[model samples]
Target: MKTYFRLLSFAKPIEKFAIPYVILTLLAVVFNTLQLALLAPLLTTLFASGSANATILTKPAGWADVTGYLNYFSQQISFTYGPFGALKFVCGVIVIAVILGNVFRYFAQRIMEDFRIHTLLNLRKSVFNNVMDQHVGYFSNQRKGDIIAKIASDVGAVQFSVTGTLQVVFKEPLQLTAYVFMLFSISFKLTIFALLVIPISAFVISKIVKRLKEQATMAQHMFGLMISYLDEALSGIKIIKSFNATEAIKDKFDSENVRYSDLGRKMARRQQLSGPVSESLSVAMVTTIVLYGGSLILNHQSDLTGPEFVTYIALFSRIMQPAKALTNSFSGIHTGLAAGERVLELIDQKPEITDAPDAVSITSFNHSIRLENLSFSYPGRTVLKDINLTIPKGKTIALVGPSGGGKSTLMDLIPRFTEVESGRVTIDGTDVRKLKMESLWSLIGVVNQESMLFNDTIFNNIAFGLPDATQEQVEHAARIANAHDFILQTEHGYQSNIGDRGMKLSGGQKQRICIARAVLKNPPIMMLDEATSALDTESEKLVQEALNNLMKNRTSLVIAHRLSTIQSADMIVVLEDGQINEQGTHLELLQRNGLYKRLIDMQTFND
Candidate 1:
């Protein structure tokens, strides 16, 4: 119940829809019941064809006297205008009741439909916004497919289930109350006997649904795993095919698929079973009422006339309509609330890296980014320890070392992508943690090992965050990255659509585009993480030149897998095993004949 209410909070200001819906629904129910209640008058008045002594009388004063008044007026109408007149009067009343009843019902549905759509909109937006705000480390700890599933499939299920429960909770009970009231007004004793149907349906449904929430949680989780598998297969289609793991991938996915399907089948059986069980109980209740009410009328022991007994049976039988709806929607509501728990769990997660309350926004970069007594770790592993370094303005600092030496980890600390365990990183003497993330990141440009591009036009990709960038500015940035010529050669020039992750471009071309994106941003600090590592010799030269152009007159932190790319760097920092082993000019380092010399010598021999 708590989970369900939390989900409903997304549908704020719900009274806008609720108040109008209640008013119309009440009218619909009243007239609809009248449709059944009028059956008695229709039969008793029109069917008595030869009652020539019928006379007119006063109308019914209140609900308690409606049964007697109806009978009295039926005889009165028969005598006043003839049997034909009473037939016309009763038939006309039933027709008008049907029209007015449906009119109110239609408007009520319109209001409820708006509420459903509005609730879905708010819930989906909240889920997606929270997902986007998570820290970079959060993605590594979770599956991409599961995140996608929560935002897409789970939110969709919530829309149907949670909002549907709203209608059932509000409208159904009022409808049931109206039905019960009319049944009792007809015969208090028989209504009491028929009330057994309520508890029977409630108990049976309770037992059937006892474990539905647990099963639903399992199903949602399994579905996420299946989607994760699908995402992996699609993203790594090239690798899967190259390794000849087609059959292997198929088996892995199909195994989960079969499991999800089987669980779905089981859930369906339980969900499908509720309807029949409740309906059968309703039928049994009606049968009991008939046998019991019939005996009373037959033995002259009850006040209900033949026509009144028929009306009572009609009203009592359909009492199950709302009860059946309440039971059946429970199956869906249970599934939705389970999905809601998962979604809320994600939204409630607080990012470990956040600026202090007094954080100020830095509009420009000046001086150097300094690491003072900095140290960091992961679970059970130290990545960087006692690291102190400085990246001065307008100077290129290259990081070169053997793999697993913490070069990338050091780079991540500059922008506070990962928090430090000890010491501080200060930008111009103000701690980075005390600066708003947007302000710090705005001054830093990053081009990673993998070229990340959206499926969009080259112009848009280059000007991604700078949405208002002019065409001339984007082309100038592209030219600086040596990409203007290649971009124009494409089918649509700057406006040409680059397929997913720039798959339409070669490795060199893609790197140049990434550089162009950085150049357009024109940040004062640049971090190039092996930006040329994945390219061939020819492509590497093109991308290396683009990197040189992007780093001009900027503070640069370069991590290169290929040692030759950083020989001209102003200072070379050699990291080994989470600590800085050496720092010097490339020539000075080679003269030291230390780790830097050995690394350069080995790379020189390979070249």
Candidate 2:
């Protein structure tokens, strides 16, 4: 229930629409109840004989003063005609009431539908925006399928909850109240006998609803797991084929599928029982009424006429519709609460890194980047230990190390992707933490080993970081990275669309376009992480040339897997066991004969 209230808070942005939507729903309920109660008197008047002297009707005691006003107005209209005129007027009033009820219902339904879609759209956008804003570490622990499920299926469930619950929450209670009041007016004692079953039925339905909520929560979890398994299988199709492990993956998917199917069936069965149980309880109540109310009419103890008694029975039976609706609505509320909890979980996650109070904007970079006694760790393992380093402006510092030796981790510190545990990283004399993240990050360009590209045109890919870049500027950047010639050779040149992750292009082509994108951004600081390590000799040569051009006259940090590539670096720092083992020029490190020398030897022997 608290989760639902939190979800309702999202409606605050559109309160104008929501307020009117609720008001119109209440209005529709009023008319619908009026139309149903009017049936009792219309039937009584219809059964009267042509010459029978009809008794002047007294105002119904069950309604408040507002209903009394309506009753008076209806009676005045009834008196406009002759003796049979009340019956004719009653028929016309019922027709108008139903028409008006439907009209209000139509607007209410439209408003609700709009509200659901608009709110859902905003929620989806918010989730996607949060996902985009999360750090790389956040994605490392999440499954693509689960994220997609949250946005698609889970969001749809919330929308259904909003719309479905609105109808029952407003309409059913009014209908039930109107029916109960009409029944009591006809014969108070019999209404009491029938009403005794309401609380008992409510209790039974509530008990089932508790179990239904548990099943719904389990079902949603199973749904997330199933989606994650499917995502894994599809993403690793190549690996499965290479290892001939299709059967193993299929079996795993089947296991999750079985769990999801079983949970779904259980949830559906629990929800399915609500309507039947409520209807049965209502049937029992009706039976009690017939037995008791029949005795009153038979013994002449009650003043209800034969036709009035019949109308009372009809009106009492109408309570079952609303009771059934209310019971079913509780089931929907349970499902919604479960989904709302999941959404709230995502919405409530605070980002690990954020701008601090009094953080100032950095408009320019000068002096140097200083790392003082930096230490960092993951959940259970330290990745960097008391790292001390300084990088001056306009110098290329190459980080050479074996795999898992904290080279990439060191670079990640520059952009504040990961925070240092026991040190301060100062950029141009100001601690990076004291500077706004957006301002600090805008000064750096990162070209990763895996070239990240979207399914868009070559021109758009180059201009991705610079949305306002002109066509001429895009071409100039491509030329600087040596990608312009190859791009022009393609059918559509700059307009040619790349497939997902740039799978349509060769490895070197992808890398060069990534460089082109970086060149277009023209940030002062550049971080290249094994940018040419994956390419063949020819492609590597071309990409290296482009990188050389981009790195010129920029403060650069390069993480290289192939040590030979960084032999000409202004400074090479070899990291081992999360600490710097050697630092010097290529020939100077050879003289020292330490970890850097062993790495060169290994690469030479492997080659």
Candidate 3:
């Protein structure tokens, strides 16, 4: 119930739709019930057509006597005009009642439809916004497909099943009450006998769908798992094919599919059972009511005339329609609530990293960035330990080391992408934690080994996060990164679509484009992680030149694998097993014949 209510809170200002829907639905129910209640008088008029007797009827004493009022008015029409006129009048009234009832119901449904759409729009927006705000590490621990399922599939399930039930919850019960009142006015004894089915039907149906919520929760989880499998298969299609493991991947996916389908079949069986079970119970109760009521009428122990008795049975049977709807809604809410719980769980999640109350924004970089007493670790393994370093303004510092040496992790700390475990990273003089994240990120640009380009036009990719960047500005950045000429050779130049992750471009071209994006941002500080490591020799020369252009006269931190690239760096720091093993100018490190020299010698031998 807590999760259900939290999900519903997204439908704020609900009264805008609720107030009008209630008024309209109430009006619709009244006329709808009147249409059925008029059946008694219509029958009275029909049976009396052969007789010319104008019987004067007494008006009922109270307003609750709906059947009495209908009978009195109907017979009065018979008394004034012939029985044929009364028949015409009653039929016209029934037709008008139906038309008005239907009109109001149509408008009411229209309002509810608007509410459903409004709720869906707000709910989806909230879920997506919360997801976009999470820190980088949060995504590392989560499955992308599972998050996607929560935002897409679970939210959609909530929109239809949960919000749709709001209409049934309000309209069905009001309708049911109106039907019950009319039945009682017609014959209190038979109505009481019919009403007993409520508790009996509820109890029996409860037993049938007792495990629906548990099964529904499990089904939602399995669906998320299946989506994760599909995403993995699509992302690794190349590797799967290269390894000749296509059949293995397919069989793995098929196994999950089979389990989801089987669980769906089970849930369907339970959900579908409630409808027929309630309907059958209604039928049995109706049969028993008819037998008892007919006995009363035949034995002359009751005051109900033949037409009124028939009217009672008619109204009694219609009660099951709303009852059946309520039962079905009860079953559906379990499934909706299950999906709602998943979605709400996401919305309730707070990001581990957020700006402090007194965090200030820094508009410019000055002096240097310093790491004091720095140490960091993952779940069990330390990545960086007791490391201290300083990067002054307008100097290029390169970090070269073996794999798992924490070079990339060191760069991430500058932009506050990963929080420090024990040490402080300060920009100029203030702690990075005391700086606003947006302001901190705005001062740095990054280019990774694997170029991260969206499936968009080259110009759009280059100008991302800078929506106001002009074509002239974009072209200038591209030229500096050596991407301008190749971009012009493409089908539409800068307007040409770069396929998914820039797959349509060559290795060098994609890296150059990524460099161009960084050049466009023109941050004071830059982090280049193996920018040219994946390219061929000719491509490497071009990209290395472009990297040189991007890093000129800027505060730069670079992680280079090729020893040749960083020989001219102002400072080169060597890390091994989460500790700084050497730090000096490239020539100075080689003179010392330490780790840096060994690395350069290995690459020299390989070349």
Best by lDDT: 3
What is the lDDT ranking, best to worst?
Answer: 3, 1, 2
lDDT of 3 by residue, 1-607 (tens): 7877787788888899999999999999999999999999998888766556635569989788799889889888888997788899999999999999999999999999898888888998999999999988899999888899888888888988888888898899999999998988888877787777578988998888778888988888888898999999987899999999999989998999999999999999998898888988989988888899999999998989888898998888898888888888888888889999898889989998889999999999989999998999999899999999999999999998999999988888888888999999999999999999999999999999999999999999999968899999999999999999999999999999999889899999999999999999999999999988999999999999999999997999999989799889999999999899999998799899998888998998999
Query: Using TM-score as the measure, which candidate wins?
Result: 3
Clashing residue pairs for model 2:
none
Give per-residue CA lDDT, model 2, range 3-71, as digits (tens): 776766665566767787778877787787777667655665565435367555566564543333344
Candidate 1 accuracy as lDDT: 0.89
Q: lDDT of each model, Cα atoms only?
A: 0.89, 0.83, 0.90
What is candidate 3's local distance difference test score? 0.90
Segments of candidate 2 deviating more than 4 angstroms: 50-87
Task: Give the distance in Å from residue 392's predicted Cα in candidate 2 to where it truly belongs.
Answer: 1.6
TM-score of each: 0.97, 0.93, 0.98
- Look at candidate 3 and give me any clashing residue pairs: none
